[model samples]
Target: MRPVSVRYDNSSVRVCMKKKAMCKIGLAVMLLLTPMMGWSAKRLNIVIIVGDDWGGPYASAYTGIYGRNLPSNVVKTPNVDRIAQNGVLFKNAYVNAPSCTPSRSSIFTGRYFFNTGGGAVLGGTWDFTIPSFPLLLLDAGYHIGLTSKGWSPGTPRNAPFGGTAHYYQYFGTSVSSFSKSVTKWTAKGMPFEKAKQTMLDQVRGNFEAFLADRKPDQPFFYWFGPTNTHRTWVKGSGKALWGIEPDSLKDQLPVYLPNNPEVREDMADYLGEIQALDAYIGVLLKKLEEIGELDNTIIVATGDNGPGGFPRGKWNLYDFGVATPLVVWYPHSTGGRVVTDFTTLMDLAPTFLEVAGVAIPPKTDGRSLLNILTSPLSGQVDPQRTFAITGEERHNAKARDDSLPYPARALRTARYLYIRNFAPDRWPMGCPYVAAHVPYVFHDIGEPSPTYDWIITNRSIPSAADYFTWAFAKRPAEELYDAHKDPGQINNVADDPMYADIKKSLAEKLLAELKKAGDPRVIGDGGTFDRPPYTDLKTVACQDTIPLNWAPGSHH
Candidate 1:
């Protein structure tokens, strides 16, 4: 029994004189480090929880062709289906640019949202020489932070995650304005479920102030980016705050959106802001099961794009505008499983640097799913994880005209989706009127509710003229689809003729994945994303009015 040496640090250094010799050196360092602790592998702790116009094949956990024609889920999200019943749910995820600052700058630089030059589109310009897996897990020491919208309406210039000094926002982003700050904190009298429980206690007081300001055992990486499911809510707050019955979502619409009752009460108020972000993700999964760090944390819910005032969902790449809503969760892996892997939130910055062992940055175009999340072989586990490749140069750099960037690119596979409209003579949505950034007329379809006033007052009525030419037409620079027979991509069988050899073999496999990712829009007369720091509309500045003070009565 020669195991009782004496020394215990607890929270600092303690040479161990007494206190029962520091409790027999914490019982001889737990019997000599409990069997090499899996070769010292406790780095995990990442979190993510993204969400912002969070899309998915409208969730029934997307079975068969990923929620084929909206499989189910009117909106329950038991804590986002209990983090997909404790992890791994991505029925084919995506988002290599659907909008929100180049789909969160391709999940903060796993790369390929057009290689994120000017953070590649939609108010772009955060390209601080790209390389930010949360600032490389805050330079490998970890303990990163971020609350509302992280790689945001870009132009931040630097600090991919350590900028606003590791940003927490005591409680500002006002829980991303859920129901307009709970209808202005229930009009100041404050009791509408106590002003929505103070915006879900501002998402559990900003992740308990970034886990009580990390330091001990460090290793964090939060991000929690909420956005109230991105868009102007409150038009009958999905049956007034989540009863969610716009006629029970009119048989789960989606035939190229244009169903009735004001677009089924705006798709039941965007599924009541995703059931108020699943009750703020069950208050961050009961604060990581009461701070024990819920099995050393990995979590990851997801979504950075899709469904913002519908119609080919947010800034279109289609597949419901790069549908996302992955899942993940960790610790022993494989629970309630389902992976079908062809993911891309730029494979989550090399899957958070291969589960924090970190180093995967040789111009990463995303790959480390860490053996398809510790594989248990769920359908399509990895077989080179098939294809994903989405793109869109500009979302609203004034849609077009002197700013022009509706350039496009896409490739999704597992039975094709292929598109390539690199400016099919422009106007794919923008300039028939409002050409300086959204104010009516095809502003890249979103944010004008009642499905943009029932397709702009039924554009000449003929059965709403094919729902206003499938939400503002302008195409034909190739577009194939057999995505297992057009999974609501609204049929664009390219130039038919027996799929012309499947559209010249998926346009040479999307131009060899944009010339193997040099992608200055196909690297030739691609016009380097067509001019000036990709049409540098003055590095998209101007943002001031931020006085929410966490809104509930907003401190008078």
Candidate 2:
């Protein structure tokens, strides 16, 4: 018919032109859509804040044993509270390991520490090949950047023990104080005022510069790691920030120690460090809002490991050492939902990708909490998602009296915790003479905190035995606790007949999980590496014989 009308009117010519123009526009739209693939939807921005060696329930709002003593206003963390108020707070969050490098490895790769080459802590020449959260985001056309530690010091760049660093090249790196301190143990203990000022100045400048320089066109993934909550007693620092004197903090002790006044004072300094860390977080949040990026950004705050100490925590399998605070705030998820399900730091990598709407690699051991964030009706994680496992190989050996370390693993569920100690005869805390760890265990023990003095002096008293055992006892093959009744894990129930079923069930599960992840201790019938090697071995070793690796780098 149109051919017959070849003698077209001017109107027909106009119609033809309009149709051709529409076709061109459609083609262009399709071409543009092609690059979008499945991520055409709005992308989510991510920011992670990691507190060094912070513990769970430290914030004032929680009623757990850890926070029971904090006055509503004792630790003024309005900003941290704001995050919890706006988003969900995970009540049972944990690290795969209680030590730094291993916990961080879990956070980065979304795999169990046993699965990672770093068997326990930063040593073990940890493998970095496992994919990281930031790396996943970067691959998805998002701008990835980190201001603090990404993949760290003890991790090597090879085989099962070594892996890849996703953020090394993709993200622009800022000199991080925490990472630097980890690299080389300098400035054992900076004066409180100087340390606080130094940290504030460096962190502020770094954050401001980061926000100022980020690429606007792409969504960003930024991590700000602060070195405050980790140790090396800085006096008077807590008073200036939290308005709490060292004595007041000592009075609010989480653990009672009859012997060490200096150790108690040191606890005050540690609490002060937490306060300072909280303050910097406030600063970072304000800066983000100033840059007009706070709302759309998803913020995650947690610790790299548990509190750095001896006995009941730190290199051991106890709530005080491995359990940590995990607060997440997303535009869609911030509604104060409290999740009691067990979750590990390893889940962080997958969670980051899922938030950004990226494909999660099958190799990842973590599952996204995004579904829980978006669906409040879904109240709990799956029942199978009931356990958390952690281990230890070596920390700063130079910092311990025992230069050669022990290997250990733990399995924790809602009510029960089972720890399998491979070398019960080995010292749990480093030896008193190994230079790297000597000062922290010996000189520093009586100087800053009572807990240390109490631990060392009362190892012989039967009533105080568990308390001391929590800190330094060599153990049997296994230790078990009913976390519901004993969150402190003061008693060993593994040998008790009453917990026979629990012990058997927990031990079995632990074995399965560990075997699945290929842990050497499990596979080799309980053998351990002598000590993980470090890049700065000689330098770190020279510092203390029991050298400390707590100082943040000068630039960070």
Give the whole-model CA lDDT for all candidates, comma-separated: 0.72, 0.60
Q: After superposition, which runs of candidate 2 have C-alpha atoms over 4 Å from their true positions?
A: 1-40, 63-73, 118-120, 124-128, 155-201, 246-252, 255-263, 377-381, 398-404, 434-450, 457-467, 524-556
Q: lDDT by residue for model 2 over 1-556, one digit each (tens)?
A: 0111000111222343466676455445434543553334456778888877777446654544233453223465667778877887787788777776777777877777656655345555644445455555554556555555545555353222113332222222222333233223325655545645555666667666655554554577777776557655444445544466656554455542332455545555566666666766787788778877788888888887766653455656677778887888888563777777678888877787667655555457777777666656423655666778877766655533435555788888878889888777656654443333333443212122345645555556687766655565457889998866665566678888999998999888988987887776778744445533422233222222222332212112
- The superposed Cα distance between candidate 1 and the true structure at residue 113, in angstroms, equals 19
- TM-score of model 1 (CA atoms): 0.34
Checking candidate 1 for backbone clashes, the offending pairs are 382-385, 551-554
lDDT of 1 at 74: 69
* Model 2: how far residue 493 lies from native, Å: 1.7
Model 1, residue 501: what's the lDDT?
A: 85
